[model samples]
Target: MDDLRRIDLNLLLALHALLTEKHVTRAALRLHKSQPAVSHSLAQLREHFNDPLLVRKSGKLELTARGNALLQPLSEALGKLNTLLGTAPFDPLQERRRFRLALSDYAARLVLPDLMRYVRVHAPGFDFAISQASRDAMLAQLADGELDLALGIFPELPQDIQVQTLFEEDFICLADKTAVPDQSGLTLAQWLERPHVMVALRPDANDEIERALAAMGLQRRITVALPHWSAAVELLPDTDLVLTIARRAVGPLRAFRQLRQFPPPLQLPKLAYQQAWHIRKDMDPALTWLRQVMADCCTTGMPSG
Candidate 1:
């Protein structure tokens, strides 16, 4: 602790720049300092840590084992310190910001259109980058700061993640109209017998539909397994593949006149679609505004199919 107190914050910042840039001149340029000043800081850092944090390897600067170990935590600490001390009143119309988000295609279909429209008119300076991944991967990305927010069915989560319910949805069966001409919906036995198209993002992960069936000592044949909701719905036309998917995902099928939606034959648990982020971001004004906008998009009569 005494050693830490003796170290200057500027020295830590210099170390971060050095480890990141891997060259004294580059680190100096990044820190807007003279090369000699940064070199002096590095020497001080090495003496304080009792290790040559950076070494010349293969004729280039490289991090030693201890330096490599310090990079991630040091980066995270600097980030938190910046957030704590550097935050300013966010102005959506003036501040240019980009957010990274993860969500299923269905959630994107439901929320993004409205969100985009609003941002275009109200927060034109804000930008978004979106990606799709499995639930576990999304959670991992959130923890690692790779993703700013994720929207999906997160039934369980770690303590460090904060979640807010956007909406609640349940399963509906979508099938080719020609395949189920009855229009009255299928009986439980008939539903179980038909080959199903399952939207399993991870090949090894079982979905809620499978879990519900397993509780009743039943299993349905999965004729197809794929990760995408949009593609899965498209496959229903001119085929016998029935997709047991979230009701919200059915909105796009309005264009697929050949597809018909039916209530699931058996009761399934309600799916709570949510937006999640690392708790470390809770105090971020920009993210707070974005989350509220998303919640408004969900509640303000966006199509629920």
Candidate 2:
């Protein structure tokens, strides 16, 4: 008990990093310490535990049985400690941090440009890496601490995750000005007859549109499907096809294309986008500031197009 009390707390943090990464270099990177310093800490940890916490295997580091045994309890304890300490009183302007984000295409368009601008003005050294995967995949990454936050039409998040509604958006029709010929709203008959292009980020993404049209005993003729939003946009300029996209997405596309926007002929359900994080990060001061940045950016840039 006395020896436990005397052990430095930072050593525990290094141990947690080492267990998580199973590599000295990555653990050092995570702890923001030099590799040699982390190596020394690892040696101390070995002495304290009296076991080879990590072992070389096939030219890569692997956690030993003892290290694997320590991972879960250590992670839980550190998470509690982090929540209690509140992340060293975060100062965004002075810190060099990298935030990994998982964003839907709509959120990226509505929030990212403005977010980047704000970062340049206030937190120059802060950087962001964005992933455009489906919300479920991103949320999984968030739960594992591989992603800092995910924002989009996320659903069915785990109970230990927390979410905040960022904004609500409605769908709008997009088409090339020349191909569409008529800038006025598409009639129900015309909308049903025109070939539709789809952005297939999720399998049921068009369900809302389909349900709305089904109410009128009408069906859309979706002739082409693209996996990417950019590809969907590229298709519009030449084909006599239209795509219904979230309101937040259209504004940013205007700088690139002269696309015409119209209200969807069908009454589509509103989309609520949310930002989600693991409960473990709920008290992180830096993450709190970033969520606020996202909120502020969304408020200012809510789809004039």
lDDT of 2 by residue, 132-192 (tens): 8766678768756789998867556664468888888888898777766677868878878
Quick one: best lDDT, which candidate?
Answer: 1
Tell me the lDDT of model 2 at 251: 59
Give the clashing pairs for model 1.
Answer: none
For candidate 1, which ten residues in a row score worst on lDDT?
296-305
After superposition, the stretches of candidate 2 with alpha carbons farther than 4 Å from their true spots are 1-87, 176-184, 202-207, 211-219, 252-260, 301-305
RMSD of candidate 1 to the truth, in angstroms, is 7.8
Model 1, 1-305: lDDT tens per residue?
87678989999889888876677986787689999999999999999889999999799788899988887788788878887897776887887889999978888889999998888877899989999999999988886668999998888997557899999998889889899898877899999889988887876568788889899999998888888888888888888888898888877565988887888998799999999997556657789888999998998843221
lDDT of each: 0.85, 0.77
- Estimate candidate 1's alpha-carbon lDDT, on a 0 to 1 scale: 0.85
